[model samples]
Target chain A: MQGMIWLLGFLIGASPDSVAQQIMWRVYNRPSFQDMHAQITMTLIDPNGTQRVRKMETWSKKDPKTGETKMLIKFMEPADLRGTAFLIYQHKDREDDMWFYLPALRKTKRLAASGKSGAFMGSDFSNYDIGGGEYEDWNYRLLREEDLDGIPCWVIEALPKSPDVEKKSGYSKEIRWVNKENDLVVRTDHYDRSEMLYKRTVVKDAVQIQGIWFERVIEATDLDSGHRTVMEFTDIRVNQGLPDDLFSIRALGR
Target chain B: MAISWLMVLLAYTHLGGYLRFESFVRVDSGYQIHKLATTLQLRTTLDQPGISGFSALNLIMDRRAPDPVIFRPIELYLTFHRGPVDLTLGKKILTWGAGVFVSPSDFVNPWDFSVLYSDLEEFREGIEVADFAYYRGNAFVELAFLPMFRPNTYPLPSLQIPVPAGPDTFVVFMDGTHPVLPEPTLKKGEGFLRVGGTWGPMDFRLLAFRGFDRDPDLQVRYVWLPGSNPQEHPPDTIHLRPEYRPVWMGAGTLTWIVGPWELHADVAYVRTEDTDGTLPTVKNPYVYGAFGFFRSFWNDQWSLGLDLLVKRIFAFGQTPEDPMGVNALLEEQARMLNFQYEETQPSLAFHLQGSDTRDLWRWSASGIYDLRAREGFLLATLSYAWADGVSLQVGGLFSGRKGRSPFSQMGRHLGQVGFLEARWSF
Candidate 1:
């Protein structure tokens, strides 16, 4: 009876783990290209348990086939932080051109990738951190199928090939838990300097738009420091009426 | 020195009549400072006082570097970039300390191409010194020669203390006794030597220095107390015991980085022999100070730093009533009190600012207090730097220390300072 039941399961091809893996690949590697303008708030928790918050407006666009992306970030707050900008054009083959504009200094400094491993907005994120809402910066491979809370999910493992790549990637290998139902990443584990699980992020409150699942609430917690940050999204509009000039340097002056 | 000046003059003469003029004026009306100063400077590098502030007018006609010049090899006279070592020649200065209140290298008396703080004293009293450097990632080393010089002496109105005048109506006093450092890497001239080297994160500096050679020009004044101003009367017996190699001075610094914080400290110690030249001190003087600062970036446009500097200067002293003829001044309340002028300055300093730039759009405010001297100073500067490396900066410094010796005296001061400069590079 057990052998017959196993054969029946194999013939059905409806295993929960296989379903999660399929969903994860379909969701993360969705379309060829997508662009969005977002207001990002990053909160940094130091080893001493002190918290600092910073806000920036960013416009990011990525192309997976050509492995290219462009980012424009502008700071808005605390008066002194206004008028500062960062423009990055990324290419997969080698280095990316990074430019930082200092309002007070009235100058733009070109930064190299070797400096990416440093702090970002006083946060733990390295300048070279691989996220940046892109798919090409990291080589993603479906590692395993796992279940969380009786829900099937797919786990992915990524390894950076070069030292520069590693510096930009805060993880040697990050595991993403994608829900089988909607092809959305539900949770992620970020490692630490010792290659131990140091932090985790949980994404919830998902809403499907244009046949895609997007989460509105993202929470990241530091395991060692007992500190965490909660980021919520609003004005959740996708592909609304955003002018081309809105992303141009000319608009910054006006 | 002669060749460099003549080279600058020849270049200016070739320019003919195309001389540019620029001036910057900064006005601040906040935090109890409501003063104004306008700096107008011109460049020709001519062999004369091309730029001068003739009491009322500030004529600046520098012959070396004027505005709007594209070719600036003059600014890059001697360039040395061998391996990890870099050096520069043709009018450049080296500064060792990071103190905003006081810089020990100010005694070197020269201008530096520093990214910050360029308001320097008269360069005419500055001598030529060799600049050196070495660097290999984490380990770095540097050695420099600081030349001491005497400035041109001018005549001033005589006071009621009866200062004897020379054959003419002027009482000029410019010392030309010894030549300053005649050789590179060797203490060529002078009775003392200043040689030091910095290794790794450590800064070790020792200066064999000398003091006071009977100028007979310092006029005496009454030392004033808070409530009264009085006439200064020197003790009947006095001494001007000139001592050679009378002191050995040194300082140390350690800097390390962790996360976003740069932990740094500046520690200095100076031990000098008990001399009769300065004040009423009866024992050797020693001074030491250590400080640290952390850089905090609020956002891309905003960054702030917090620093705490602890300093102490001690010297043996006689009883309070002992008087000195060294320097005397009138008091504010018109009453005199006899006391030893020797003192120690120990204080805490705090500096907060949004950003630092050569553009007038960027601003900064700074304040400091000297504990033992019971005095304080405040400074503010606004600057602007345009595209193409052209910039303008204007700032002022207010220094006030109370009179301690019976012959020492000073009152509150109200003054203004500003500067307007422009530079172009390829």
Candidate 2:
């Protein structure tokens, strides 16, 4: 059954434990990733009914096999937040180091590693959101077997690492559904403080194009607010040659 | 450090704008240089509060000379983002509230840039504000707190003189004339906590404080009150009185951001309580206040803004919340320094005296108008502030007695004053 397959994956990744390891490589490793850049739009509603809108641009590269990843994100609009970039890399042992280039000082400086959970563009997304987009950062344990949309899946109970793991994470633990046919995760149930499911996500339209399986559509819904974002990945071409300098602060203006 | 200022200058020139630089040096913490090098600042705003406007600058190269330096771990502060929750370290502003009409506290925390408001001398002062956040999603919150351990220096506007014979013994400024609050001290232990967040639309914030401060160099007042007293004030209240003004505050703010217009308001009720009763008011009552702001922007170059504030000190003692006067605690501390003074006690006549007793005070408005929209060719702001009141008693001790009413101390409690600043940075 589906449960059996999910259980197999969970038990396989259960605990590299106690010590530190690049769990991202084991849990959410994807191969042959091309240069990815997203133009993210963020909106904030204040108590006074004031709303602020911001445009964020992000660029990243994944080796797919070696798990080497590098990323750069910056603000595009808003005069106050015009030139800001966050540079991060893949690392083991201690957490990855980060540096921010501020336009005001017009310099790039090191931010303490402890500030990873700090806000990124003042959005709900955190440095953990930058955890190389790995699937294994969550503690996965087989919970049940089920079907999402139509594909059979294995339900796994997974908890995010810890506060040490990410800052401002909305969910403590997540219940995810991994496809039995393919080794990719297809759905997730995000829990709140009381350990109650507050968000549910469904990823569909999967196809192993060019030897790699990928989800085409992802819908994340908040149980309390009923606000949701349906992300659609288009032109997802993997293994496009990207230069190392593509993820540098120098590449910001370009 | 040199490169940072170069960029600002270049940015101002190449970008066709203006900039201002300031570096205030006086000894307060272990004979160290306060604002050593200079403050390369270029402030411009997008949206305005009440008439409130937005601005930013770089607090650059605050270095201490090697000869007799205590510590200068904080070198430079750079900002790249402007949003609800601002993230900063080293030297930056971790601010909260609309900073308009009503705010809980304006103590420039340990974090270099914690309190970034007109009421503050330098947000990049006091305890280094570790980090600050303001979340207004469905849930909202704003908080700023930092390490409270540093060299100790009392707020001595009067004691501007360097200790005649201290270590490495040197005196640059004979008279204290330092800004506000004490320098820094490790014995103070951990700093107080100031946490504020909102749920839905109700604004909320809280503050934990230790030291104190006097009135901001500048404040707002109604130029014309209906009938109270002409000699009294310019029409504002809640003077940042000199006092051991310690407390924890909680409050909330509401804002409406429309395409290019921003209308925001905030209200707070804070309890002024500290670990020690070293301040004038021991059993100080809670204070309430509110603020309103309105701003408009045209494209990315032209804009205008407005801001207003009002606070109320309900009970007795030197109500720190008497937003009309000044920080009483700092005045006593200033005695150690050498500063100018006026000898006269406040009159409780209420009718003639521009000041009130120990109860009820308010701070009217805070703002700056945008003169330049694109590149700062020219910018100007017309602001007026005045505090009208008379102390029927000098916070009680000076109540019945006219001469013994701490007349020397009453040297403070000036009726009211105003200021105007026109800056050309490039």
Candidate 3:
């Protein structure tokens, strides 16, 4: 397990800044494979640059006897959000179980996981940036080692350790970077709740497929409404077995 | 030409559609023009592998219709599936409860009050059932049936009665009532049975219907109007015929999620055939209900809903004192069929809606009222999506009444309307 967490942090003498805070909890507990299927494409833009675009199709998984993870998404292209759909489940200790189908009200509803910091289809990526937040609800630290754009990074920072995780993560600190050769997360900034900064993400083309790694483009932006989002990913696939009735809820209104 | 073979199978399937164009202008004084429309809708999908099919079509034209090209066929169903059952068939558009603008366990399809307040899924309409569903992990079990019987399209096709000639004189007819359906016999079809699930943060359903009564029940007919010198001003004409009966419901719905609010409820009970209440053209057993909450703000780009429906009426009799009032003038012309003339009616609604934060401007407002029939309704809209399936909108509709409510006799007979729309989708 990453050499038993670096031999229990080198037999507890642990320092060097807590081994860069155990590499920010091993880059936020990285490890994958249990099912996925993608095909995205987002866009958005605005600040008078006018853009829009959408398209989706997702499917996640991870159950293996309820370790919970589900997912599902749908919306293929913006014909006013065609066929809608969205589901989630996520859970490890609570709060996450959403649904919303709406193919022109063929109903489905059930949302409100406290709007996990909202945005999401109006895009600057929220819903806690598509369900990724939770490593003891944030505390991380590291912040130093540089090089991004020439690879070799590690920045970290995090923070939100409650206030209901800073009010469900409308964030009040974040500043990632990671990827010192593979822990992914290429960039982020966010902050807002008066801590300023307010959104920025970046990640870009990183491939690898079957042996994991992913991240094919992302973008975000919104430094105070100059609005932008990008996303991308495509046909991704991972661990094949899929079908738990494709995240059930009657596969979210077909 | 089945719409030219569905426009030649929409060029090999999977198509979708939309095209609107509206324009109304009534200001009640001066602006005039009232309506001008254009609609077109299409839809297609076919899938295969245990069969699947779907279709939709509409097409309108309206320059105040007297025949301005209409055509409908809103759906055409066909599912088949297998391992866990599924079996649709023909015209569909089912939508059961979770009330949001009313859904007392939605009754099979009928409510195109000629687009009353438009786009509530185009006021529903698509019926010819035979559903059947099954599934079991997240629970489900449906069972439709229906088979003919659709009625509920009104924008008043005639009715202007007012006869009484003499001593203050009057005589104006127009009637055209017509509506006495039911006879395609599969034992006069209509059916329902649902049962739903999802149980952690709740979500439920449970219905049961035995249908027939998408409004209609009023029967009076009188005529005499022979004058010219043979009589001496003898006028009278009042014809109202509608009649369709058979009811029985029992609905239910629940939705819950309590953390940022999202509670819902919907209930029903109906029974009809005057169950105890003197039948002055039947309508008595009742119980309906709705209760709601929904929220989302700022980050969700604002949203809010609030509801309250309620309807009670059970054995509320008394109405045999009309000496010469002629049955209170056929119960005031059947109160324009929104029925439930009292015995606790309640109502209250709200909507809100918002956008803009690059969602490209949008807005909304809604209201309802009707508490003890003091009556109310208001709507407002503003939109602009401008692309990705185009858009542009402007709207208004208002009503407020105390004029002895039946929604103030349908707001003194359908009196407000305002619009400007444009859309496109593909």
Q: What is each candidate's DockQ, to 2 decimals?
A: 0.03, 0.01, 0.23
**Candidate structures ordered by lDDT, highest first:** 3, 1, 2
Across A1-254, the per-residue lDDT of candidate 1 in tens digits comes to: 32243246458975634443344446656653266676766665545655555567777666546757666778753233555788666766645645456643333333333345444543444454434434434556656667877767667654454554554555565677877666667788876545788768777576676666777667667677666665555444455444443333322321
lDDT of 1 by residue, B318-396 (tens): 2233243233222111111212223444555555554431112556656556555666555566655443224455565
Query: Model 2: per-residue lDDT, tens digit, B1-426?
Result: 999987764544312122222233222224333333433444442322212122344444435434432322222332233444444444333334444322334433332211122123242332454454443431323343444533223332322222222122222222234333434565443344545433322333455544333221211122334575635442322222222334444454554433223445555554544223233323333443334433322111122334443334333333253333323533333322211122211111000111111112211222222111111111112321111111111111111111121222221321111222222333
Of candidate 1 chain A, the 10-residue stretch with the lowest lDDT total is: A245-254
- Candidate 1 second chain TM: 0.51
> Could you tell me the lDDT of residue A233 within candidate 2?
51
**lDDT score, candidate 1:** 0.43
Instruction: Report the number of the highest-DockQ candidate.
Output: 3
Runs in model 2 lying further than 4 Å from the true structure = A1-27, A41-54, A63-66, A78-80, A115-126, A130-139, A160-172, A204-211, A215-217, A227-238, A252-254, B1-426
Give candidates' CA RMSD values in order. 16.9, 21.4, 22.1
Whole-structure CA lDDT of model 2: 0.40
User: Which one wins by TM-score: 1 or 3?
Assistant: 1
Per-prediction TM-score to the true structure, in the order listed: 0.42, 0.36, 0.34
Best-matching candidate per lDDT: 3
lDDT (0 to 1) per candidate: 0.43, 0.40, 0.76
Tell how far residue A117 is off in model 1, in angstroms: 12
Docking class of 1: incorrect
Q: Compose the digit string of candidate 3's lDDT tens values, residues B127-237.
A: 888888898877889888887788766533356655553442334343445666889888889888888988888888888889787877676555555543324433365
Of 1 and 3, the candidate ranking higher by DockQ: 3
lDDT of 3 at B44: 80
